[model samples]
Target: MEEDFVLMKGNEALAEAAIRAGADGYFGYPITPQSEVMEYLTAAKPWERTGMVVLQAESEVSAINMLYGGAGAGKRVMTSSSSPGISLMQEGISYIAGAELPVVVANVVRGGPGLGTIQPSQSDYFQATKGGGHGDYHLLVLAPSSVQEMADFMPLAFDLAFKYRNPVMILSDGAIGQMMEKVKFQPQRPRMKDEELPGWATTGKTPDRERNIITSLDLDPYRQERFNRKLIEKYQKMKEEEVRFETFQCEDAEYLFVAYGTSSRICQKSVQLAREKGIKAGLFRPITLFPFPEKQVGALADQVKGMLSVEMSAGQMVEDVRLATNGKVPVEHYGRMGGVIPTPDEIVEVLIQKFIGG
Candidate 1:
């Protein structure tokens, strides 16, 4: 455990932490907001110190395929991109999911329907937690609200990816990705030795064992269905065991604000402002957006008069919040889109208008 603290931007911390977490390779193209991830890694020269393989792929599509190759070899691999780039990688992402490959992907999201803006936004929530590509698959989505979490979740993302043998995404945004904060990194871990590769990995097989094959294609329909079922079961297990969230001033509250990533930070301040104005308000921040602390949100629904889902997008996560509440209370969405972040005062005003005004 290294307790030494250092100032670092979110993207830089993420890159450094991946290296420290024993990631064997990173393949990605340059994308705003997250480009620093590769930039920092290249400048840090992890290849010299840890023999980590860092390569700048020609495009997002190429980068994700490179990740597939590295992961197939049983190497800890990762990539980072912004909105448009992530969209370009969707096909490869779907294939990786179908093959049940363990890989870490960081989406430092920006506003986008298509190359919308380079600034931060949470609009990618749907594409992230839901099946972005063509498949009945899910990525373990971790939403980091701070620069510190941007660093901390790197190892955790890789851990979960390998633990479930599936893709894990760190769903951040421009705010967290570019912001600077004090971070204390964990000590570096040694990379997995070639001999330690899983038996299922595509390492050269011995005469005693069968060859390892990694493929998303199964022509047989029944076999493919079985594979899909297995993947669903794994997702259910993740939901049951890995749902994570943070609560602020929820006890005995009459109103609740649900948010994640950068939006949650703004909501926290709004909660304080509401309290000052004699409104009983609390905030629920979903740390794991995929598993999505549904049970907790449902429980909160029983106590609160109304709940508001806040985001830097057009009401994406609000749907999940509604599903969690199950119509138990009046749940509404408030957001600012196109790389615009809502202010705490704005959130407080919305809360008052929707839940408090007669």
Candidate 2:
């Protein structure tokens, strides 16, 4: 099948890809850095073309609940927001996780602690990988570094969300969301047939099957514990089967740079710069931040002298790098906060000052 390639912003590409991937509904509130997601969907009028449902919700809370309702009915539904907005949806996300519903959420992350800035940042690393809500639940987190992956991961996120019966997140930063790049869209697929939905989906009961109900509330402590344990087991299986990362020039490297999302793209250029300066530097980019590719990072720790974790946050993912390395090698973090992005040269300088020269 032929693919359609076009120059598009990451958020717009994601919106288009969802329709092409047969998304049944998109319910979202407009927010900077990611407002284009809903804007594109509304303007393109997917409802007229593919009969997809598009609604501008009153707030982030309402939008996420709408996602839960659509997902409960076994429809491929998604919502997108920036950092503060995503924070508002945490409760709903947790409830969805508890009820074992499938929904795709995209966070076009911006700098934050409280209404920080509209520019790019990766401060939400902890929020996305760790539980942002009240529970032991984990989101299947995919970090996209480019506009292409921003579009590409939409189908993959929905596929994984349904396959594991869990919530999935596309953890993108504002830079990637706003940047223009060439994206190739997959051919459109039809939405799932009504009968093809899982038996657990709340699509009205049939005479031959039990009634389908969706709820996160378990009054009994024992039953809630069991449910939580089941969720843990599922997470373990995901770690075993879904860890994804890309290694660049790692074969003979003495120093490594670990990053994800936009930082990873900058790290790639830093690696090239380091190589020109006669420093054997490689980069490890984690595509799936939740499954984390810990095993791969651990293996590289044995080969490299040290590693530097580059991020737009103060130092979130560096903790994961240290854990993966098991403290066997020195790992340090360098970052710019509140919407400022560190340059490749700045990263290289940190590599020299912290890991190499010192």
Candidate 3:
């Protein structure tokens, strides 16, 4: 039998779901909206009873380094923060990607330029999906629009991170992180083993067989080029295997809505309202930002008259949408910033103006 559903905030659900997924360690600093996740984990006794190692680091820099250490030790580890904290962790994140360690990071994004605001915002879209730190690497970025999705995506993030030997990120926002909604917990799979650790792990073995060295430094240009090629190969595979999206009433729609994370939730309501008004509006919600559902969106563009990219930022995913549509459809943007959110009614008006050419 399935478990009963209960209301939960996105951040709270994330913490609980990660614990259920058998994450062995967590390291993070306090940040608005996302801070509750750390609070929940600290209070839940997941560390004391399950032998999980939960630590509140002094800063985001220290927190991410802690994740690097835990992942290098072959332990399932995670961390959560908002935009500024995430910014601080970029160095560690890049290192994790280069070393091919599996670690999960959650960013309940707020507005940004520098010290933007505590309220909800989708401003981190580009940063999360486009290799925020340095190098030509991509993080598996999952955008959860609802609290329920927050719970559902946690284990998936972990699985993908380990499978790809790369960092994975849950890119939500303050709205989803702070808002309460119902969620049904799924039956979790058996706990994973540290044995899943690749041969690259430093197990401190005898000197006879071979010593494993985990470093991104390849002084030889040819070797460095080879490493880059291998990384690109994995990214190619990810593009094929990991793209995920949710479509609503898109089959015969005249207007398409492109949105993700908290912005997409409002888009859902807007689509419903448009239907009530006899306007053919549909929503294309990208669940994975990096392994973007570009092909699917391109297919939809062939049928739709136009597309609207909605976000809390000025325009980030808008660029990706344009790339996906390939200049086939008239793509427009509607958004708010500095922690303000676009309402369903506002989105409908934009649809009216853009689609109807009003």
Candidate 4:
């Protein structure tokens, strides 16, 4: 049993977790800091043991379309990429959302506007949570702050994907993706059988049943409006049922640091450092970013003097934090962008300077 635990980089753990989660297929293109996900999958060769198919598509565009096809057939499928790669997949992701197909995706994010450096970042918060592509839609986004979560989130994301019949994204960063940590493998799950496929799957049509034609196209304005409304209802359901977050030492704190993914890990350390300085500080980590944990942060506002949103980008998440706090308290934005990671001490001092003051 102990042998099931091993040290792995975040990307490697995510790859192993997918196979153990009974994923039917993975279609991905190589991208820095995230390519290891596909590399590990191909090397493990789960096809023999679990019958999972692993394919390397020629481009991010190709990979996402392959994911669309696999998912439309009711297969538990996934793909992963970094920032620019994810940007390329936007159109297809929107299409899958419109069709209401379930699939998991991991964005091991790096710094980016375009062709950004292969370094850790959390700049894609807006894109991931607020719909990167076209039209009205949302992808349930999970932010993993550690390698263990990189492994743990695969099955969770898959389950939520199927439950909502919408795309689920593991919004990771290069720091987490490349860093090594111990991961205990999940118990292996059996792949879904043909009999277990969902009713809406576009498998071969039987004579006794109506054909399942999966598509995102709706030329009629009235029908397109209906489709949009249905998607809104689904997003509302997710907001009600799927909001996930964590609070540390917030039970009795005067200041709060709200961050996610790699930034959350840094803020956790800052919390400890601030405590040593006689400042009552706590860390609020958002595990599910899409729902944005609005009510939770709003509730926390009454107890804290101020909140600082720390991120690996130029304060992208700060806007959400401000919206969540609802002007009850001052919510300041502090971050290091373009592949730079903020240190624990740096965050502590910034908190004091930003909200505490000399």
Candidate 5:
């Protein structure tokens, strides 16, 4: 198949990918660092080409609920928002997860405790991975480090969502969302017809089949308990089979760097800088943050002397790395919150000071 390539902003790639991936609808409110997604979609006018629906919702809460409705109908749907906006959508996000709907969401993160700065940060790690919404639910989180991944993850996220009957999140940051890169867009796939919708879809009454109901509400405690158990089983299965991560210079390294998304890219550079200084530093980049590369990170703990989990947050993911390592090695966290990005040189210095000097 011929690949179509384009140089575009990461956010634009995301919108283009959704259209090319045959997404049925996108409903979202404008939020900085991620507003380009909706703007690109609106400018492209995908409805004219692929019959996709793009609506600008009044708020993030409304956007997420709109996505839920489209997803329940078995249509590919998605939304994008930045930090505070995502916070508003939490309740609706939980609802979608509870209903076991297949949809994709992109979070282009910014600094936050309240209405924080528009600059980049990875502070949302805890929110994205630790079931940000509510209950015993999880969104399959994908962390993309490049513009290429911004384009590529859209289709993959949709596929995974439908496979597990769950929602998926592309946890991007302002750095990647605004950066421009050359992306090789995948070949287009035709949209699914209403008749071709999956068996579980609530596509309205059909003469030959029983009515399909789509919802997350179960007033009965026992019935809801059963559903919760099913969701737990689904998450376990995903952890066992769908964990995705990347390793660099790990075959023979004494120290390790664990990160994801923008932080991972910076850590990759830090590893190189550390290696130049006669330090054996490897990088572990987790692609799937929820189904975290725990087992793999645990395995590395046995080989490395110490590790540092880098991020743009006040160290959210470092806790996960500590959990993954399980006290086998000394683990430390290094980062700047409020949208400050750390430098590779600074990261290597921290590694040396915290581990070797200490």
Candidate 6:
């Protein structure tokens, strides 16, 4: 039997879930709509009861560096912030990825080119999945569309981060961060018994071995290439195994709408409206943005002649939609930005025009 669920905001759930997941440390600076996350944890029992270290760092830069230190110590850890804070942490995130450290960071993204807005937006799509900071690397970007999924995916983020020895990101938005919904919570999982963490973790060594080192710096070019190859292999495995998505009314529909994060909530409503209007419309929502649900999108393209992308931005994910549709199906985009969420009615109107125009 499972415990009864409760309604909670996505950011609160994330904080609670991270606590329940046995995360040993959390370091972050405040930024809205994500500020509630740090607040929840800071005021909660995780620190007093579980010996977890939760700190509000002076800035995002310091917060992420603290995460690096915790990860190097072989402890489960997490950090949370909005776009501007995330931008500051990008340098640290890239460093964590290069060091092959298992760390989790949650970005409750607000609109931005530079402090564009404090409201929700999916404008960070490319930034989150395309190695936002620098170099040839990718963070496993998980986009949670609901409050339940927000809570549910926090532990999954940590598990995957540790499993691959790579950084993982929960790419959310202000709406999801602030919305309330019923969600069942599960007991924390026990630490893995079969596998001890890598020896490179900065755990103090026994007399039998020498001090271990963990870093991204490799002076030898050949050695650097080898390291890069190993990272690539891990990413490939994730691409094969970790891609995730949800489909609604996609089967037998003539048109498909693709969205993620908070945008999908509106898209879900659009699907309902489209159906009521007798338009054969459906939705494909990507939960994992990096190892994207391209296969599913491609399959849908074979059936649907037209596809439209709904995002909070003018068009970032539209590119991915085009790639998925292979230039065969005509893809369109509709959005609002600087904090305005695209309403379902708006999306439905777009679909009606595109589908009925022909």
lDDT of 1: 0.94
Cα RMSDs, all models = 1.3, 1.4, 1.6, 0.9, 1.5, 2.0
lDDT (Cα, tens digit) per residue for candidate 1, span 55-171: 999999999999999999889999999999999999999999999999999999999889999999999999999979998999999999988898889889988999999999999
Candidates 3 and 5, the one with greater lDDT:
5
Clashing pairs in 1: none
lDDT of 6 by residue, 96-155 (tens): 999989999999989888988888988888989989887779999999998888889989
Clashing pairs in 2: none
State the lDDT of candidate 3 residue by residue for 141-256, as single tens digits.
Answer: 99998899899989888889889999999999999999999888766544557576667677777667587776667789998889989999998999999999999889878999
Candidate 5 on 39-79: residue-level lDDT in tens? 99999999999999999998899999999899988999999
lDDT of 2 at 225: 93
Q: After superposition, how far is residue 299 of candidate 6 from its true place, in Å?
A: 1.5
Task: Give TM-scores for every candidate, taking all chains together and pairing residue i with residue i.
Answer: 0.98, 0.98, 0.96, 0.99, 0.98, 0.95
The local distance difference test score of each candidate is: 0.94, 0.94, 0.90, 0.94, 0.93, 0.88
The lDDT of model 3 is: 0.90
Candidate 3 residue-wise lDDT at 157: 89
Off by over 4 Å in 1: 1-3
Report the C-alpha displacement of residue 330, candidate 6, in angstroms: 0.9
Model 3 segments beyond 4 Å from truth?
1-3, 188-196
